[model samples]
Target: MRRNHLIALATLGSAALLLGAWGFQYLGYAPCKMCLWQRWPHGAAVLFGVAAMAAPVAILTLAGALAAATTGAIGVYHTGVERGWWEGPSSCSSGDITGMSTDDLFNQIMAAPLVRCDEVAWQLLGLSMASWNALISFALVAIWLAAYRKSAP
Candidate 1:
């Protein structure tokens, strides 16, 4: 495909993923902090895609690639958090509460978010949504790179 088409495809791919994430949210999957963080880069990429189409600047394509990579990295981090490979944000992750007073513990429980970043609410074939995002976003990165290379003089 031509550079513009490739850029459009990559942008559309991000839009589709974002829509899917929102769909899942609408279906009652409340996104945690990390999940929400993963969406921003996709949004930026979509904007970058528009700029790329309007101007076809190499820099915009590069920015799109970076945006994709940012989301992909966040996805990987979220996957690790979900799998307990590492800790997530304290506000979103369930941590030890043993030292807290009874009232404090109760308050913490009551104030806790409905969604926990450390838990996988949905998955397919042992891969969580974050994992899928990472995989797909990386593919989009490749598309962005291809567009960039194609536009290179």
Candidate 2:
């Protein structure tokens, strides 16, 4: 495919993912801290995609590729946390509070976010949303890379 088509596809990929995240939010599926963290890169990629549409520059494609890869990595990390393979941040996941006082524990509980990063609130075909995001973002990464190569003169 031509460079412009590739760039548009990559940009649309990020936009679609962003829209999907918002759609879930609108449906009352609130995202956790980690989930929200994964969004920034996609948002950036969408912006990069728009810029690439105008300039179709190699730098823009490279930047978009980086953004896609960033979100993809976050999605993988989030998936691991959700699967209990590793612990997530204390702000969004339950952590060891063995030495905390009773009041401290209570305060922590009270201050806990409505959405926990470790919980799989929704899934499809045994894959959580994070898993799907990672997979799609990987594809987007490939598309962006192709665009980058094509944009090269």
Candidate 3:
């Protein structure tokens, strides 16, 4: 794997992630907080890929790999949150509401996000988007690592 190859792979992965999100949105599937959380690192990976393409540098490829890995880790955490293996953030998931006025409750309900990070809106072959992202992003990370290894002096 060369720098250009790694860069291309990273870019393609970012494009795929973006397109997948857009497709889900287009189909009326809104992203939860965790889903939104998973996208930033992919965006960074894409940018790093672009930089690598522009300069064909080993550092940029490694950066892209790091970004991919970050997103993949987040995706794994998200999958756990969805599967009830762990708890998600209070901003995305339900939490204890022992003390709250009716107005506060109403406001919370009204301001609450449409999507719940703890629930899977879609899945295929028992894999949700987060799982898919983990698999794909991890593969991208491997390509990047291989590129780095092969380019080592």
Candidate 4:
């Protein structure tokens, strides 16, 4: 396939994933902070793909790859959080309240976000959406790499 087609495919892949996420959101799955963070790079990659098509620059493809990597990395982190491999950000993750006053505990409860980043909202074949995003975004990274190699002189 041509470099432009490869770039477009990679870009569209991100777009499709974003749309799917939105679809899930519309279905009443509110995205947590981490989930929202994972979407940003995909958005950037879609734009980078358009820029690559217009300029056909190897650097743009490289940037797209970086964008993909960023999202992929975040997905991995999110998956780890979901699996309890590690704690997520305090703003979204449930923290211990072992030594809080009644008022403090109440305040924490009131301030807590509706969506907890450490919990899996949905999963398929034993994998959460974040895991799937990581896998697919990594594939996009390879596509971006191929585009870069093809366009490079």
Cα lDDT of candidate 2 equals 0.95
Q: What TM-score do all the candidates reach, one by one? A: 0.94, 0.97, 0.89, 0.97
For candidate 2, the per-residue lDDT at 2 reads: 93
Model 4: clashing residue pairs?
none
Candidate 2, run of 10 with poorest lDDT: 49-58
Clashing pairs in 3: none
Once superposed on the true structure, which residue ranges of model 1 sit more than 4 Å away at CA? none
lDDT of 3 at 4: 74
Each candidate's number of clashing pairs is 0, 0, 0, 0
Candidate 3 lDDT by residue in tens digits, 33-108: 8898889988888888888778756787788889999989999999998998988887787655779889988888
Give the per-residue lDDT digits (tens) of candidate 1, residues 1-153. 999999999999999999999999999999999999999999999999999999979999999999999999999999999999998887899977878999998888888888899999999999999999999999999999999999988
Candidate 4 structure quality by residue, lDDT tens digits, 70-117: 999999999999999998898899877788999998998899999999
Alpha carbon lDDT at 115, candidate 2: 96
